[model samples]
Target chain A: MFEYIVSKYNYWVYIFLMMLGLYGMIGKKNLVKKLIGMNIFQVAIILFYISIGSKVGASIPILTAEDLHGSANPLHYMNPLPHVLMLTAIVVGIATTGVALGIIIMVYNRYKTLAEDEILEIRKKSGV
Target chain B: MKVFALLTVIITGVMLVYGAEDFPKWGDPNQPGSVHVAPRYTQGTYIEAGTPNIVTSVVADYRGYDTMGETTVIFTAGMACILMLRKKKRGEGESNV
Candidate 1:
């Protein structure tokens, strides 16, 4: 069990980070805090995917001169698919954060508050 | 409410950890992910895409359409932010609506 846990400790660390982000998103009242939590969650996921592509003794996903002429050995390089997929994911995450912040700004402008509970109270009072 | 949030987080974490147990050990070359198309891409990237950097070729050449879509998504996001936050011009129609 110790060896099993030790071998996969990276997953454990990422899970912990994800849980922390989840807690921040769920427990915080402020909109910006939730946004921050969401960003953290995204970063954790990206890191997890990047880690999935790693090899014990592999170089980066670039071919050397010998590798270029001969058939490139997959084991000699880290997996590149995860890194490529995560590149798109990172772009999407940035877009999400940008739009979310814009919406939060609009919400604050109309409600005059950033707290979720206070905004709810104002909405109830105003019948909106 | 915070207690409820913590409980939810703990439950989610436990489930994820349980699922993660099935994942291959770190840096195992024979793992399912590495055994599949990764080898093909690694072998053919130079001949097919003429790029020594496999990642750059995969993103820009192999998955060009996906990258294009990603660019569109970012453009949409920028437009949304501008539309949402831009101030009204002076003497424009009623600002309340």
Candidate 2:
């Protein structure tokens, strides 16, 4: 059981990071902390993808004359799809972080408080 | 809370016992996902994409639309923040602040 779990450790890591990030994102009151938590959540997905794309014995895919000749021993080739996906995911994560931070700044400016409770009270008083 | 935890533990244990039967054999070649669907991409994604990588293809082509939408969600959030936080100028006073 231990060995089996070890072999699939990436999944475990992904789940752990995801849970941690989610907890922080949902449980944290400070806007900045929530943003950081969101980033953590996104990063977990990236890790999941990268791990999925990996093969134990794979080589990086780049064609060369030797590769064409077929003389090179074809042992293992690293999967590329997940890495590609990770790139997009990383970009999206950054965009989300930027937008989330922007919202935090806006919240700060309007309510002069980062606490969600404080903002909610202000909204109530303002009838907004 | 204690009852909830006990319930959860019992349910999880039951699932674990039954799930083993349904779970796909680890690294079974017959798995649909493991099959090499395309020749160029089949052997491995890195060789096919001319990049040193498989995840790339899945992200770039397999599910590119999903990623695009994820980015758009951020854009929408940013716009919402701007609109919500917009304040009237000092001369305009707090009428619309």
Candidate 3:
């Protein structure tokens, strides 16, 4: 049981971080706070994936001649797939954040307030 | 309203934690992820793309198409931001200029 918990510590930390982000996203009233939560959530997810690519006794994925000479061992290097995919995910996340902030700006310009309740009230009144 | 949001968050967190039980332990060499197509990329990087960094080879060589799309997404996002936020001043109109 101790071994299991120790080995899985990274995942547990990620899960906790994910919960924190989720809470921020859902429980917060401010729109900008929700965006911060979203960024936290993205970073946590990226960290989780990068951790998955780790190996107990491995170097980076750049191959040496020994890696080719002796048996071509996969264990000699950390997994590279997750790193590659997460790079794209990070770029996408930045794009999404930029767009979301832009939308928030437009929303604030029209509604004159960033509070969720006030915006809803204005929307209901203005039939928007 | 806050109470409802908090309740939903707690429920989701519980479900996520429960689901995490089945995931492979950290840094386990034999995990399916490490054994799968990862080996091909690691083993074949030099010959396939002449790149020492496997992440670079796989991202820019094997998956160049996806990267192009991602670049387009960011560009579109920038254009959208400008289009949404920019206001034309009365004196700056094409006819006036």
Best by TM-score: 1
| Candidate 3: tens digits of C-alpha lDDT, residues A1-128 | 89878878988788888888988888887899999999998888998999999999999887777665324578989999999899999988998999999899877877778888888898798886
Residue A122, candidate 2: Cα error in Å is: 2.7
Candidate 2, which CAPRI tier?
incorrect
Q: What C-alpha root-mean-square deviation, in Å, does candidate 1 show against the real structure? A: 1.6
TM-scores for the candidates: 0.95, 0.65, 0.90
The runs of at least 3 residues in candidate 3 whose Cα sits more than 4 Å from the true structure, single-residue gaps closed, are A65-72, B89-97
Tell me, by lDDT, which candidate is best.
1
lDDT of 2 by residue, B1-95 (tens): 33554455455445544544443334333333334542245344444344433345555655669877877876786787676566656686454
lDDT of each residue in A1-128, candidate 2, tens digit only: 88767666666656667666766666667788778878887888787666655555556644344454333333345544555556766776676666667667766766789987788888899898
- Of the candidates numbered 2 and 3, which has the greater lDDT value? 3
Ranked by TM-score, top first = 1, 3, 2
True C-alpha contacts between chains kept, each model in order:
0.75, 0.15, 0.69
Q: Which 10 successive residues of model 2 chain B have the least lDDT summed?
A: B23-32
Write down the DockQ of candidate 2. Answer: 0.21
RMSD of each: 1.6, 5.7, 3.5
Winner on lDDT (1 vs 3): 1
